[model samples]
Every structure is written in structure tokens, then in C-alpha cells.
Target: MALNNNRYSCPYICPSTHMQGEETKQQETAKIAVKPENILSAPYVPGNVRPRSPKVYPPGAPPKYLPQPTESTSGDILWMSPVGPWAAGHIDWSPQAGITGVRPVVDKYSITRYSTGEWRKNNQFTLTPRATDKAKALEAETQKDVANTFSNLDKKLNHSNEMLNDRIKELSYWKKQVQSTLNGITEELAAIEADRQRLKGACKILMLPEAISRECLELRTGRYEPDLVRDDAEQELIKEVAIVGEIRKIFNDTLIKAELQIEMIKSTKAAIERDWSDKEISLKIDNLNYTLTPDSNLILAHPGVTRWPENATTLEYWKHYCAESIRNCEDVRKMSAKLRADLMTSITKGGEDMKNQANRTNSALAETIDATEQMCEKLEDNLKDNLQKIADIENLIDYLKESLRNVQERNKCVMTRLHNRNYERPSVENCRDEAQYALMAEAKFIKESSESLQSKLREAESVRSELMKYRGELEKDIACKRKSLNIDKDRCARVRAHMPTPEEFAAG
Candidate 1:
């Protein structure tokens, strides 16, 4: 076969083929027959340009170009890198291509050691399968554990959610109960407060009747002399003042009780309201907890939050506490109702009593005024009759005086006639005569008549003086009665008219 001179040539040809003559032929045959370890250098070639063959070809098979190597080595080509895509960019490997009987460089030694270590590690026959199987089993176990963990988390979350829902429901129930109690207590407090106000109003109203009673008593003090005596009207007025005072005291006491009761009711209401407020907040908190989820943005890590409170109450204690609060509210409500009822009773009775006493006082005043007016009228009539008797006595005394004067003149004329007769008839006339005897008897009779007339005049004048003194007393007494009537009937009665009605007192 002819050798072609090309630098890019097949590296399968031996270098001894370049010799001439029989020696050349002999070298060629020797080279061809060379053992694997005795082969020399070969040239580099690319994998795609020159495909490799597994076995060597004998001489005279085909003509081909071959590369002349610049150097040679004495070694068999134990192995060559196969030409393929994997061998691209690698140093072309041919027969007898490696270093021959020389120590490798440090980098080559390092590469060889590294490659040997990799091979040895890959060829761990005993440990690889077992270890691989264990790793695979671990992977499977990890996957299963993860799946189980997820499942458990889901179950636990569901359970916790259900518990939160139940808790929320419980809170809601208690909230409703607390709210009801709060409402009841609130209403009771309002009623008690209103009753207290009414009591205050009633007390204020009582002042009017009390003032009237006191005023009436004061007016009675203005009565004159005999009228100032404690008559039925005066006695009734005094009693009215006492009664009004007593009623006022009772109202004040009732008002104090009402105020105290109102405060108690208000306190109870406040407690119930506080309980209700707590329940409302708890309900909201529980509802929020029930609504929460692991994915919720509101969720956060609260360390140690799951711990139970040391002061937490048990179910029985909780129920008892709730029930006790409601019971307390109910008790307070009942108390408020009873208090209001009692207040109502007090108002009614007090009002009626006040009105009745006022009426009695008014009636007594009216009767006393009528009696005074009648007494005044009778006194005036007696004064008129006494005056008429005084005038008739004065006329009778004048007539007695005139008659006594005429008798005196007649006695004087008789005496003068007797004296003239005695002087004119001397001793004969002085002798015991019928004219002298008649004159003497006439004088004696005149003297006795004058004395009797004078006695009658003195008796008449004494009687007239007594009657005039009695008339003056009567007139004075009548004036006093009139004054008393004016004070009682006119002034005090007008003040009594201002008394509040029973309905007004009750309303108060």
C-alpha cells in the first residue's frame, strides 16, 4: 500500500513503514506483529474527521494517508479514548499514545489519584445498594411523616375551631342572660329613681297644707277677748297643724327610704351592666377566635398562650356565678317594685289624711264664724231695747218733777190765806177754827206727797243708770265678736282655700 503524505492522517499506520528495502519490509512486519506493549507513538486525530476502528487492519488492505509523528515511544496502547461526542475537545487518543516507562508529572499523578479514588468510590459493592435503599426508605418515611403531620395539623385545627365555636356559643348564651338581667335591673333602677322623685314632690306638696294649718292657727290668735277662747275652730286648727306636721314627717321618712332604695337599685344595675359588658366583650373575643384560621393575617405566634390560667373557674363555679348575678338582679327588682308600691300607698294615705283634716278645719271655722255673728246680732238687739227703756225713764222723771212743783205752790197759797185770817179777826179768829185745821191738814198732805214723788224719782234714776252701764257692756262685747268673726271667717278662710287638692298630692 502507498502511504499518503498528509499531516491530518489516520494514526493506525506504524512508523516503521517509512523504511526502504527488505529491512523496511522486515520492520513493517515486525511492527505489524508487535505486541500490545511494544507499540510506538501514534499521531493525534479528531473524532468526527476520522472515525475509529476496534481492530487493527493488516497490510495490503487499503491505501490511506498517515501522519508522521514528530516523536516516538516504546509502549503498548493498552486503551484509547473512544471517538464520540463525549471525546470532543479532548486530546485525540491513538494506539501507543501514553508516556512510555517514565514517571508521571505531579499534576498527572494528582489526576490519576483523583480518578482512581472516584472509581474506587463508585465501585463500593457492599455498601452502595444498602445505603441507597436506606436513603430511599428514609425519603419515603420523610414524605409519609410530612403527610401525617399535615393530616394531624388539619384535624387539630378543626377540633380547635369546633371548640372555639362551642365556646363562642356558650359566651353568647351567657351574654344574653346577662343582658336580660341588665335590662331588668336597669328598668328597676329607673322605676326606683322615679319613685324617689315622686316622694320628693310629695314632700314639697305637703309644705302647702302645713303652711295653711300654721297660718290658720296664727290667724286664730288675732281673735278678741271671749272669742280668743279655745273654741272648736281653734282646737281643730291646732289639731290640723299637728296632723300636717306629722304627715310631713312621714313623707320625709318615706322619701329617705326611697332615696336609699334607689341607690341600692342603681348599684345593682351597675353591677349587672358591668357583667353584661364583660360578657359582650368575651363573646366578641370568642367569636373572633372561632373565625380565625392558620392562614389568617390576624394570626400570630403568641408564646405560652395555650397555658390555662391558674385563677380560672370551673364549669360549676361559672354557672353558679352567672346564676347568682341574675338572681341578685331579680331580688333587687323585686325590692324596687315593693318599694314603689309602698311609696304609692304612703302617698295615697297621706294625701287623703291631709285633705280630710283641711276640710274639718274649714268646717269648724265656718261654724264658729256663724255662732259669733249670731251672738253679735243678739247683742245689738239688746242694746236697742236698753236705749228705748232709758228714754222712757228720762220722760217719767221729768213728769214727777213738774207735779211736785205744783203741789209745793198750792201749799204756799194755803198758808198765806190762813195767816191773813188770823191777823184780821183777832182772838176770835185765833180760836180753834175749821179753816186753820183744814190748812194744817192740807200742808201735811202736801209734804207727804212731795216726799213720795222725790222717792219715786230717785228709784227711777238709779234703774236708768244701771241699764245704761249694761248697754255699754253689750256694745263692747258685740264689737269684740265682730272683730273675731272678721279674723276667722275672712282672713284665715282665704288662706285655707290655697290648700292643695288630694289628687295633686297624690300626683306629687
Candidate 2:
């Protein structure tokens, strides 16, 4: 690529492809406007549409339609083909391939100009041929279209990535909410289980046999005295407790399953987010503004090279843009599919929860009813035995009452006789003194029993207070430890979430 001696003569570096001579040597006269829009696929004049002047060039190199020759070299046009053999340079053509079948042109092939000619006075002649003007135009058009394409791509990728980030966050938030709800249900189930356990213990005691129950009370009270208790009340409480325990167990199982579901959904949601992020950034889309240099494709914009080369490269670039656009469109399609899948999964999970709730309710109710019925049947059998015992006790009470009446009559006669004879004889006085001493001994024994009972009661109360206070302290400690465990679990989860996925560091 040799340059003419005159540095300022050719504003264009000129295209590298060889030039063709036109037979119509006469200067072109028609004025044709080659708009920048006409050259590009789609014209996107960002800030302005100022069309710069067509750069000056030798009359032969520019397209016949661009700026016509404002000035001519006015020299004898040489006649010779371009320099080369088959592949290195030009080929021989007839005069028709020369200046419109009128004058021969000088090229690397040979000296086709047989006669010498007068040289131009001061004007410089171009030595370096250019590629076809159509090629240059097409190149320019491709550059502009590609630039716009890349610009749109930059914005598109950014917007898509932003949406991707938002979706990931939304999934995380939704997962957190689900987990929170799951935790609540789990706590409720635990509380219900504790309550059921306490009730179960109480119910077991209530269903104890009457003799055993009396023993238990007497052992605790240190007394043989009996208080009336109803078999019907105990049976009713047993039935209620059995039913409640069955229901509580059912709820506990259901909540356990629900907690598992929350964990499953959280894991699945995280995978979805990770996969989407990978797919979105897989193209290295974030680096498009730097990696995609549309400016580099602007061969037409190179100094003084606007009207030279032409080929299928323009159409090729067009195809490339279309392909890139399709890829982006596919990304959008996949994103939509992902969102749709998420929606369907949510709806499905909701339906499953409803089903689980209904199933749990039915199972709890049915099991509770069965337990209650079984308990009540056992209680009925016990009640029948208790009733027979009651009848026997009633007969014994009647006989005892008759004996007490006879004894009371005899005792009244004796007391009257004693009262009349007392204080007159030495034997009567001795009996009266002995009876008063026996009464004093009985009073002293009763006071001792009362004091012993009072001491026992105080000891029992003190023990109960101490146990209650210790239980409260233990519960508080347990609550604090549970809170710390939850905080640690959350911290661990956050750390895991911050970890990168496989996509972040993979090579292109």
C-alpha cells in the first residue's frame, strides 16, 4: 500500500482492493443523495442527523452516484492492467474493462498505454487503488446497524439482569415467610403436645380404681377419712382427655410434615434462583459494552476510506445481529417459563396444604372419637361395679344406725343414773375423777395430732414453692438457649446464601 508523494493530496487512506475503470470517462453530472439511513439496516441517529460532506477523492474510485468529480486530473490516462499474475495482482481484460471502452488505464499488469501523454501541471494522481465503493458503503451500513444493535443489547441485558436479581430476592423473601409460618406451626404443635401430656397424666390418675384413689389421697393427707368422688365425673374427664390427646397428636404430625415442606420449597427456590442467575449472566452480557466493539467494525469511517470495498460481509453482519437478537429473545422466553413454573408450584403447594389441613382434621376427629368411645366403655364397666358396692354399703349403714340407737338409749339411762348418784359416795367421786382425767388425756392427744398435721402442711407448701420457682428458672434458661440456637441457625443460613455458585467463575 504505497502512498503518493503528496501527503495532503488524498484525504482518504483509500481502500486496499483494486479499482475498476469506467468507460464513461465523461464526468458524472447527476446529483444523488446517499443518505446514511439508506445505507444502514435501521437508522438510529442518536443525537443528530448531520450528514458530513462526501470526502474528496480521485474521480475513478468513488461510486458514480456519490459526489461527482468537482475537479479532474486532466492528464493522459495510462492503459495497463493492475500488477499481478493469477493470484498476486490484476488480470488482463479487453478495452471494455478499461475506461468505458474509450481510454486504457494504467495498473500493475503492464504498460497498456502505448503512447506518452502530457502530464498534469500541479495536480497529483492517485497510485493506490481502493476497494469497491459499494463495499465501503456496505461496511459503513453494517457498522451503524451493529452499533445500534449492541447499544440495545447493553440496555436489554441490564434490564433483564435487574429483573433476575429482583426475582431472586422475591423468592428468598417468600421462602423466609414460608419458613416463618412453618416455625409458628411447629411451636404450636409443641405446646399442644405438652398440654396433652399433662392432661394424659391427669387422666390416668382420674381413671384409677376407687380403693387406689382413696389410698393415694390418704397417703398424701396421712388420714383415712374418705371424701365422696363420682365415677361419672372421672369417666367424663377421661373421655375428654383421650379425645384431646388424639387430636393433638394428629396436629403435631401434620405440622411436622408442613415444616418438611417448607424446607423442601426453600431448597428448590434457591436452586431456581441460582440457575436463573447462571443463565442470565452466561453470555457475559454485563461486559457487552466493552467486548462488543461496533466501532471497530466501522471500516468505512477510517480516514478517507468511505468508498471502497463491498461484499457479503454486510449481509453476514446482518445475520449475526439477528442471531444475537434471537438469543436474547430466547433468554426472555426461558425467564417467562421459569416464572410460570414458580407460579404453578406455588399454587400446587397451596392446594397441598389445604388438603393436608383437611386430612389432618378428619383424622384427628375420627381417632379422637374412637378413643373416647373405648374409654367410655371401660368407665361404664367400672361404674356398674361401683353401683353394686354402693348398694351393699347402704345396707351396712342401716344396720349400724339401728345399733347406734339402742346404744344411745342405754348410754342415756346410765348417764342419768350416774348424775343422780354422783358426789354422794366415795366410789362415785372416784369414778367422776377418773372420767375427768380420761377427758383431759383425750384433749391432749387431739391437740398433738392438730399440731403434727399443721407442721406437715407447712412442709408440703414450702416444698411446692421451691419446686415452682426452680421450674420457672429452668424454663427461662431453656427459652434463652432456644433463641440463641435460632439466631445461630439464621446466621449460618445467611453465610450459605452469600456463597457463590458454579456460574460465577466459569470460563467463556
Error of 1 at 212 (Å): 2.5
Whole-model lDDT values for every prediction: 0.71, 0.40
Alpha-carbon RMSD, each predicted model: 19.7, 30.2
Candidate 1 matches the true fold with a TM-score of: 0.54
Error of 1 at 306 (Å): 2.2
> Compared with the true structure, what per-residue lDDT tens digits does model 2 show for residues 110-149?
5442221112211123433568989999999999999999
Cα displacement (angstroms), candidate 2, residue 64, comes to 61
Candidate 2 structure, TM-score to reference:
0.20
In model 2, which regions exceed 4 Å deviation?
1-313, 331-339, 346-354, 357-362, 373-399, 407-508
What's the C-alpha lDDT at position 287 in model 2?
Answer: 34
